[model samples]
Target: MPSFAQILIALGAAGGALAAPFANTTAAAVTTEQRSAAQTFTGDITYYQPGLGACGETSSDSETVVALSPAQYDGNCGKTITITKDGKTATAKVVDKCPSCASGAIDVSSTVFQSLADMSVGRTQVSWSFN
Candidate 1:
């Protein structure tokens, strides 16, 4: 006895109600992972020229590319990291390995380094985590 418009409205309402629980579950999962993914550590950060890097990736100043220590690079290649310093933060992709860097040092592209600190500073203490 319900009209076509009424039937569609009822179906839409039911569909929305059914989808709400799934949506909330997905949102909760994402929030939980984001909370756990943040692991902070202090390190020395410096800038480098944009060019071919040890990971065989060609980069430029315009891109947010970063070089990690050999150990970090082995596991983090092609992953993103969020670096923070002097109350500023920048996110960059791990694209290369830094054999010369100390165990906790990281080298970022000129743009990413500048985002966290002035180029004249050359190097600064930074905290970073995988995003």
Candidate 2:
């Protein structure tokens, strides 16, 4: 028969073994979330001229390009975002970094901004999502 301390040690070892798989699975889940998680939020929207974008892309007036904050731009360059405001929605590609944008603000090209709201609005409340 095993001593009480021996039995506790064996159980602890088995528990650790069982927990190892779960720990690994949790780590993988976190990695996957980091890779392709969808983010949705409301923010301020403004428009900019079509020219040299912060992402090093030359965008045209007809191209739907958007600029995000530096933090959001880090992993989201070239991603598509759907922006909705009032009763309009438009999809635009992330093409630049908006250093002056607030945490939740996104600056889009005039074409994209017009698709969601008239340029006269200048700035508007917008809900956006990206995956």
Best by TM-score: 2
What candidate 1 gets wrong by more than 4 Å, as runs, is 1-38
Candidate 2 runs further than 4 Å off: 1-36
For candidate 1, the clash count comes to 0
For 91-128, candidate 1 gives per-residue lDDT tens digits of 99998888888876899899898888889999889988
Against the unseen true structure, what C-alpha lDDT does each candidate score? Answer: 0.85, 0.86
Q: For all candidates, what are the clash counts?
A: 0, 0
Q: Model 2, residue 39: displacement in angstroms? A: 2.4
Q: Give all TM-scores, in the order shown.
A: 0.68, 0.73
